[model samples]
Target: MENHKLGRAPDFTNACIVMFGVNLGWVLLFLFAIYGLVAAVFICLIVNHWLNWVAVRRRQADQLYAGKTPG
Candidate 1:
């Protein structure tokens, strides 16, 4: 019957749409995860640079107070 065929067609289309949506969601999730990891690495590098700067400044201050040039 025409009505039976129409109903079955929609069911198949809906199943395909759901499958496509799930695949797309997983792909987006993976992309975001990679972006987050890269951002974390960048933040770590910035923090390391800041810590080294602080250490260097402290050493310079110590040298100035001790009346000696920092080697």
Candidate 2:
């Protein structure tokens, strides 16, 4: 895992999962203190969508690359 990367294939999903947890836990912890429950809920929803979307994009890219012949 030490050689794992963040945004590239193979390691991307694992990195995304780690990022999701950090954003949900630490970022929301501070947001809750500053903006309270309602605002934090909205922020959480937005963040969730963004993260999922990015993950989807990465996965699709991986599939595309896998099917392409080396040049």
Candidate 3:
């Protein structure tokens, strides 16, 4: 005989469901405020420069490979 009452899981198991009232924007602002604004901007600029450099390198590699490889 199979018992149906033992088959169900607990409702309060997920942590996200428990924090339903939290606003993520406020949390982000709190983090940014704890860190200085100038530092944040400098980090963003460095990341942007790195991403652009990588994209340029990838483009050059693609062009070089495209010319040599036969389809």
Candidate 4:
């Protein structure tokens, strides 16, 4: 079993799967951002989503590891 501290995909396999989408989305969206305001919004959205995912994952894993069901 692996310890997923920081909500980083649970394991190497999962991490790769998750990062593939993240990287691909970033590349595509960066190209899509033609205007300055649009670019800022895109970047903020990307970063916010990533941070939320990390925090949520970490919390869930912590709950599960401590023998509590993740809600």
- Per-residue CA lDDT of model 1 for 1-71, tens digit only, reads 65655333335878886997688567556755877656656655776798899999999999989999887
Task: Estimate the overall C-alpha local distance difference test score of candidate 4.
Answer: 0.80
Ranking by lDDT: 2, 4, 1, 3
Q: Residue by residue across 1-71, what tens digits does model 4's lDDT show? A: 46756655455887887997799677657666655567767776887899899999999999999999999
lDDT tens digits, residues 1-71, model 2?
99977885464888887997887798888989999998889987998899899988888888778995333
Using TM-score as the measure, the top candidate is 2
Q: After aligning candidate 1 to the native by TM-score, how far in Å is the CA of 26 from where it should be?
A: 25
Model 1 TM-score relative to the real fold:
0.49
Model 3 agreement with the true structure over 1-68: per-residue lDDT tens digits = 46555666667746664563255445445657988677556666776798899988888888788885
In the predicted model 4, the residue pairs found to clash are none
How far is 67's C-alpha from truth in model 3 (Å)? Answer: 1.2
Q: What is the lDDT of residue 32 in candidate 1?
A: 59
Off by over 4 Å in 2: 1-24, 68-71
lDDT of 3 at 53: 90
* Model 3 poorest 10 in a row by lDDT: 20-29
